[model samples]
Target: MPRLARPVPAVAAALSALALLVAGCGSNALAKQPPFPRSTIQANAADPSEKPITGSPTTGDPVDPAFAVDKLRLLDPCKLLDDDALKELGKPDDAVPGGFSRCSNFMKDKDGKDLSITVEVGQTVTSEIKKADKKIAGYRSYEQVLEGSACFVSVITQDEPGLAFTVQIGYKDGDGCVPGRKVAESVVALAKGKNASRTAAKGSVITVDPCALPSDAAVLEATDKSPRVYPYGLHNCSWVGDDAEMTLDFRGGFVPKDDKFDSKQTEIDLGGVKAYQVQTTTSFPSCTIKWVQLRGEDNDGEVVEVKSAGPKKAEFDRCAKAQSFAKALLPKLPRA
Candidate 1:
């Protein structure tokens, strides 16, 4: 099983907003900022060219979340499945569905490769691109995942009122799926969003596990100089010198345009977590840190002990959250 460590990625430094929108092709929402690297114990990257590659899907943790990995199910191939499997995966198999087996499989490319993944959705969600089904808590199955051009489907069923069971099929575009991977991903993502909204309205526990969630990830971070943060989507980010606090400016996403950093005017609110932007001041530790702190229910259901080694309370608080989040999540991580 893979586990989550403390400290979220810097990309998640900001909060994902209900009003903000994520593209169906992928989950483009994260909170932490980038450019900061501290105490990071990571693994090797996924060999994009390996056959039957079995390794951690993610290589490093985002700056917003300094202590965790790419937990988001983004690019995960488990969104498409057939109708029969959807019912079996979400319900009891006391007598098993007569004719069909409960398992789902993926299609391969012409070169003869295992380039897909299949998953059954028993929940709803729209967090990350890979976890779109998770964010909404809708039922889906990823019947196949085709290398770069992955595809999947989400089905909405009502086995347990308010909770929809989804059969998902995930496959890649490179494997020859119509409409390409991006388009397929977009279709499933849209379904995930709709299901998420519905679940929220009904107040249902759409998803019961953490699949690298979006809403539950309140961010804090510093980034790596490489893979710089892209300027688009619902993101509120900045670049801070090792020890300077320059005035932050938010144009797109949620930060109001031209909003000054006044105590009342400037606030970093990400669902269950809120960072009151006090007056900007000189920064300590003259080093850029792309780190991610945690917030919301992502903080719960786990046993944790947060002992801070700090110079200031806020620093301790921020750092502590990041660390604790990772530590708490480690136990639940799946094998990459």
Candidate 2:
């Protein structure tokens, strides 16, 4: 049996809005910004003859995620499951290319409602098994039904210490976990290692773990109090001080935009990285800092914020507080 570790934190307010929107559970009107657009990038190179095939050619056969999770960096989810594999799931449609982290498809039931399947590659840890309900394919697995809305089956793969690739299914009726497990199993079977000979070394800015981004001392120096950690969400963790709250968000899907803010935007520097500062004074006093974490190929963004209100209003400049936290946290981000 594999060991179980702690679960990766849930999506913060920002990502929770995304999840809800994607799940068809709510309207996105109140979301901070529009969801990141789906990626249309395909994997094929024009001339197969020009480039040499590296690694064993993908057999599309099941390999244990414990051994192949790192290879997900290269696996295109749309191509991962072939047509025949989709057929087994009841007339599977074409896979919908999602954001960098997800792929999806759907089939209709007798009544014509859609039953959807989605695969996501994201931050996960082996210890998540501690919170799982059962074992599937030698890994700890979780089965959940969102009542009438959807069902989910998640497996903690042995990729990195805290990362897992997941398969989720949603339907209007019956046990959604039934199909969720089926899709989860197929995803496991599809997991394969890339050829070392042909695969080039690549790095990802999205892989940064939020929980590891700030030290206790840094949190203290920035907020002047002890911090609390909220592991599950868009922000890696939330630090709560006696008078202020801070959130560190690693935006894997959407970059920050100036148009999203009704307030003035200020540009600043954090550990040599260019960042923008926004102050929100309407609802309450708060500050938000957004910076580019990975540019060019990935075009990803990162954000940190500090907000104080109520009794502490007279003590600090919220924007300055946010900047101080951003400064303290910037040195900790990956520069390369």
Candidate 3:
């Protein structure tokens, strides 16, 4: 999953609002926003005519069947970072789920230096594969070191022009690539043995395909044009039209509050549920509506977000469009 904006450490008002939101909420939750600096990984162009190792599913069979998008989605990311598998690296902390498709394990070396290992599955891999300079467990791999403190090692999983299983390591005291590559190797081995665990939560949004949520008619009503679907990571989907776009995101994070977005948010009722709406014209005219779908422990929970945006020159009510889109989607969500 992509990271959110940097968190403010001293938001007293935000915390106060969060307390009110979670007053009677039950446990079951979601969250994200990495503690480290953003990675500098960039994609490089690959030869268009060069055939991908994982052959086209339409013309032939995929070489790596286990890495297929469907199979990869069901595998629990936290389980992939097994303690036994990472024992050689250092003392790893309990794995924490960042989102549906990402997890992180924080560790300390014998010398007491900090290291963080994060694994993300089903990440879009396009031109990045062109830089695959090595191989891990028969899969083409790409490795890059950033400022000697962070490293990213990714293995191409499927070539429906691409998707990857990636491992990122942040080790300020030593060469991050060494541990990064080791973790990548361990993940590949675990995947080969079918040892990666799967999510067992009943009625989990993790199992639902985001692209399948909004119907064709609802999409047309929202964006005013035929939709082109784009699924981001495993939990977010977007419907793009000629002049407008709508996005639906299923995420785990702190309870939504008025001060969270740096703009005044209005509280609104959505089929008996409390929801927040915020409009921003910083880059373009857009409106966002978000509400808690399932409450988790503390102030965290699963959230459903709907956003609608259009070019500034287009004359339309963005907030009303977003509200309408959210109302249409609310009934389709599984009950907590």
Ranking of models by lDDT: 3, 2, 1
lDDT of 1 by residue, 59-139 (tens): 222222211121222212222333333332232111111000012233333444332222322222122223324322223
Q: In candidate 3, which residue pairs clash?
A: 28-296, 29-296, 30-252, 30-253, 31-252
1-336, model 2: which lDDT tens digit per residue?
A: 111111112343433423533353122222212223211111111132332211111222223533343355445555544556657656665455443445666555445556666666543333344457687766677765556656656776542233455665566666777867766766666654332112211333344545567667766765676654433221345566667666665544333344232246777776676677776665456777776555333323333333333233536676766677677766665564
Q: Residue 289, candidate 3: how far off, in angstroms?
A: 1.0
Return the TM-score for each candidate structure: 0.22, 0.61, 0.76
lDDT of all predictions: 0.24, 0.49, 0.65
The clash count for each model shown is 125, 19, 5
Number of the predicted model whose lDDT against the real structure is largest: 3
| Highest-TM-score candidate | 3
The TM-score obtained by model 2 is 0.61
Model 1, CA-based lDDT: 0.24
Model 3 score (lDDT): 0.65
Tens digits of per-residue lDDT, candidate 3, 1-336, equal: 222222212223422322212221212222223321112122222344654323222222344877655677777777778897677887876666655666777667667677777787766566666678799888899986656456778888865546678887767789878887888888877765566757434445656666677777788988898866655555667787788889888765455343253357888888787888989886578998988676555555566788899888877898888988888887888875
| Cα error, candidate 2, residue 226 (Å) | 3.1
lDDT-best of 1 and 2: 2
